[model samples]
Target: MADDNPGFSDPVTLFQDVEDLKAQIARLTGLIDRLTAGGGDDPAGPGDGDTGAPAQDADAEGEEEDGYPPFILLLDSPAYDEELRALIEWVEGVLVPGYLAEPSSDAHWCHLWFEHPVAVGRLHALWLAWQELTEPATCGYTGPSTWHRDHLDPCMRELRGRGGPFGGCTKNEHQIAHRQPSLVPSAWRMAES
Candidate 1:
């Protein structure tokens, strides 16, 4: 049967191809760094608790419920901007396709709910930078909680009062209710007893 045909490429092969692609990416990245620094010292390798290493078996098992495998992409200063863009594009393009093709594969499984805390923090910082660049008035913003709350609170109240998807909810509450659940076991809700 075609399903059992030896000539057919196995799922393992596809995964290996993905790994090979990632290695190629790493090599290309190294080359880019070398060129950028004009042959300066290689940036420090991944340190402890860094995102460069594969997730531990325990972590993978713990995260299984989220439907995505966990992996890391450690980026030093020079590689941050370009690598983040490439990583986001990979999530949208390559990773999504692979997940759709074989939802059960390790790659698909781990990546489905993959979380790189460092990358996320970096992205958040970048977002703040962009926001500042685009809207300077939004700067010095104490957000929603402060003695300045009186000034901001009514504005936020008026906005929330206007009624939308989050009509009456605070941002924190909205995020908690609507944000994507993490792959970590903690994110899983226990079945009703």
Candidate 2:
């Protein structure tokens, strides 16, 4: 018998695809929940814990939900999934460009940025903060600067400092340590010379 579908024709590949789609759907559902239900303070990011004040809608909306941002859906948090890949790309293309200018740091970003669980968690939280802080004040936000101060700063310190994610890695630009050992085992890193 000929296989009508070469890829999914095999039960194993079909099962894997089904599982991936289900995971994607679950992640999206959680994202929707975060958007509507307001985010709670994720343990990873700064400004965690209650203020003993009313929760602003913008503040609530920025919290990372259980499934969250979906960059963390896998056991190893690989960026092979399209949505997860897009998130990492945004951090690489947009966030890094907007904030840091050190070529060595950018090299560090290329090398160690994605291979740390804490980095991934903090970045996702920071992105949520960005979303909340960028909304207008009428949306109950003070503005995007809060994200810079509260979320972005500390994460930057951890991800970019000498003792940060790139610790023990080469400090050369136009060159990277190239996927040196990740601080956290869960994040998937790619080596590009």
lDDT of each: 0.36, 0.52
Residue-pair clashes per prediction, in order, are: 7, 3
Residue by residue across 57-135, what tens digits does model 2's lDDT show?
Answer: 3223323443233334442423334434655776887797888776463434534556565566677667656654554
For residues 1-193, could you state the per-residue lDDT of candidate 1 as single tens digits?
7577775567776655565455446545644554465443433322121222232332333223222222223445444454455456644564346423432212112231224343244333333233222221222222212212333233323322333223323423332133345566443355432
Reference-based lDDT, residue 62, model 2: 28
Candidate 2 lDDT score at position 40: 43
Candidate 1 Cα outliers beyond 4 Å, as residue runs = 1-78, 100-193
Which is the leading candidate under TM-score? 2
Instruction: lDDT for model 2, please.
Output: 0.52
